[model samples]
Every structure is written in structure tokens, then in C-alpha cells.
Target: MKQLIFSLSFCLLAMSSLFAQGIQFESGSWADVKAKAKAQNKPIFVDAYAVWCGPCKWMSANSFTDASVGELYNSGFISYKFDMEKGEGPAFAQQQSIRAYPTLLFFSPDGELLKKAEGARDAEGLISLAKPYLKANNNANQEQTTTDNNWESLNAKAWEYYETKSNRSDLSKALKWANTSIEMNRNWYNLDTKAHLLAKLDRNKEALELAVDAILAAQDAGELAEAEETMELLRKLRNN
Candidate 1:
């Protein structure tokens, strides 16, 4: 009986330590994050989340705890998870025009906004999302490379074409450009835009299919709110 009790105590301590070994919330002001990023010359990954947000909880449970995400983030970023309703972070959220919870904002060490993805991101998706930024930073120190530039410029042009196109016939070019963007970046936002353009072109069937794909992708990535929204949009498109 004494040995059994000792073993149980040891198990409990081991379990506690295991949990503690996972990602830890860094406590400090945004300035602290900035200072750390500057000192380390790393990007800052800010997870803007709220307590009441279901997707935020999912992200914490699934995506943020994923080992791949942990390795990538721990290596390249000064990651900070912010409670969007609890501190000065809330004010920053408003300034950043965050309309939803579980928004992931990536910033350069110099404090430039590199990307703002509004959704829950699973481990794989989070790692994928952060990769471009990390690559960009690393490439900055090397000889100039133009691999991503064409895709970046093409994506911008596609958005412009989308904004101006009003007819299905006019949308073909935009669709083509957006598809090219997806092939290059494979970002959720790019895919979402592609779906939007497809819907606008009266390709409701294809649009709904793409929307469903996007929904699943977002869900898998731990972007709960985005998944829900995309699902709702899919339903509405189908109904129409």
C-alpha cells in the first residue's frame, strides 16, 4: 500500500510536469514583446483571442498545442497570446480592426504588419502561415530572390480585377489570376477570395464546393469562427 501511494504521487508529478513543459504564456506588455523581437531579430506572432470565443478555445486545445507549430513558433517568433477583452491588447485589437476572435497577427521585429489572419489556425496551418514570413526574413539577409514576388503582385492584381469586374464574362481573368495566387501562396484568405469570385461569377455550384473546402480547411487549421462563417455561406449559396 505504501509503495502504491508513492507510485501514484510520482505519476501525478510527472503528468503535471508534462503539461507544464508545453507552451507557456509569456506575461508582459506589448512593448516587452517588441523588445524581445528586436533583440532576437524575430517576428512577433500575436494570437488575439477572447475567453468567450469557442474557436479560440479550440485553437488553444488543438492547434496551439501541436508539436510542429510549437517547434516553428518557438524557433522563429516571439509568440504572444493576447486576451482580446482583458488587457491593453483589447485596445490594440480595436486599432487593428479585429472584428473577430482568434485572430492571428504576424509582425516583423521592426513592428510592421506582415500578415493578419482572422481565424483559428491548427498546428499545420499555423506553421504554413508563418513559413512565408520566416522565409522572407531569412531571404532578406541573402541575395535578392524574386520567387514570391510574381505571385504577390499577381494576387494584388487579381484583387483589383475582382473589385472592378461586374459581369461573368469579365470575371474569367480575375478567376484565373486568383487561381494562380492560390497555387503560389495557398493561404486561406486567397482561397476564400477565390471562392468569393467564383460565387460572384454565378458559378454557385463550384463556389459552394470551394466554400466547403475552405470551411474544412479552416476547421482543420483551428479557425473555428472562419469555418462556421464559411459553412454558413456555403449553405446560403446552396439554398439560393
Candidate 2:
């Protein structure tokens, strides 16, 4: 009976180890990390934790090590682990308004803060928390054929998915978003984003027209950065 129980325990231990596929965190200075995320057009996932926190350790050992959680987060965002008490973590934590251990923060590529969830959770729980953000990520380009496409929802989704578009279809969706956004509000941001998306998708003729128009309008509106950036985009597109 004793031998049989020992054998069962060993098997269980091995099974547990097999299932624990730990997450891999990227290493770099905070600025470089953010820049890389922006360049890749991916959202940032920060696992804000402290070394002394038991829940933090538990998550690192269990939740974060789960294969399901690792797969979901790895594909969905550029993940980082920050020790809230160490290095640049303190100031960042303060800025992010983190007062507890194991705060999961998601940020858009444009440095806009999206969600901040506090406390530790299992793999399923964590993924559930991140689900909406993930949907928003892809749906930004999804064809909005339904009357349900309100301007606030559309614009919010566009901002969330802006740089994080995955493929050519997404790029096309971004064009749709840009056009729809112009219909809703022909303001500088919408126009500028539309022109930028056009240039990115190599839809040159319209891109050039819109880019020039945007540059002129932005300059007239005294938005120098938008004007200059759009001008540079126009130049780049023309050269390419």
C-alpha cells in the first residue's frame, strides 16, 4: 500500500511540473521596453509585484507558470515583470497608482493606459480579465456593418487598436475606422490617423491627398507636431 501511494504521489508531482509552463519576461530599460512595444504595435502588460509579497510569489510560481495563462498573455501583449520596490519600479508604480501587490496593467502602444487590475488570480481568472482588451485589439479593424457601431465605441476601439493592428485586413479595418471617424468627427486626430493608416497600407493616391490636406489643416490649427509628422509621412510615402 505504501509503495503504491508513493508511486501515485511521484506521478502527480511530475504531472504538475509538466503543466507548469512559466512565462518569459523581456529584459530592458523601461524606456526601451515601451519603445519596442510601440514599434511592434503590441500592448504592454506589466506584472507589478514586490519581492516580499506572498501573493506575488504565488502568482510567479503558479498562475504565471500555467501554460494557458502564458499562451494567452504571450500572444496578446508584450509582458513585463516589475518589482514595485526596486529600480524604476517605485516611481512607475506611483505613477500607475499601484497600491497593492500583483497589479496587472495594460497599456496601448501609444502609451495610453487601458486597464489596471489589482491582486493575484489564477490563469482562467487572469485571462477573463484580459479578454475585453484582447477583443478590442482585433475588433478595431473588424467590419462595423451593424448599426451598433456608435462613434464613442468606434473611436475608443480605434485608439486601442491603432498601432496594434495585426495584418493587412486589420490595416483595412483601420482605414474603415479612419473614414468612419471622419464622418463622426473630422477633427485633427481622426484626420491625421486616417492619413497615417493610408500611407501605411500603401494606398498612395488617397494617402497623399489626405496627408497633404491633414498637414495643411493641422498647421492652420497650430498643431505643429501633427503637421510635421504628417508632412514626414507624406515625404516617406512619396519616396517609397
User: Which candidate has the top score in TM-score?
Assistant: 2
Query: What C-alpha lDDT does candidate 1 achieve relative to the native structure?
Result: 0.74
lDDT of 1 by residue, 1-240 (tens): 999999999998975654444444567999998898878878788999999999999989888777666767777888898987887976998888999888999887666666889888777788889898787667543311332456666566666667886744335545656787788777655666678787877678888888877876777778868566566768889889
List candidate 1 stretches off by more than 4 Å: 1-24, 143-240
lDDT string for model 2 (97-151, tens) is 8999989988765455678899999878888987776776666424465424666
Residue 30 shift from truth in candidate 2, angstroms? 2.0
Candidate 1, residue 14: how far the Cα is off, in Å: 14
Enumerate residue pairs that collide in model 2: none
Worst 10 residues of 2 by lDDT: 139-148
Task: Please count the clashing residue pairs in each candidate, in the order shown.
Answer: 4, 0
- Superpose all Cα atoms of candidate 2 onto the true structure and report the RMSD in Å to 1 decimal: 12.1
Clashing pairs in 1: 120-222, 120-223, 121-221, 122-221
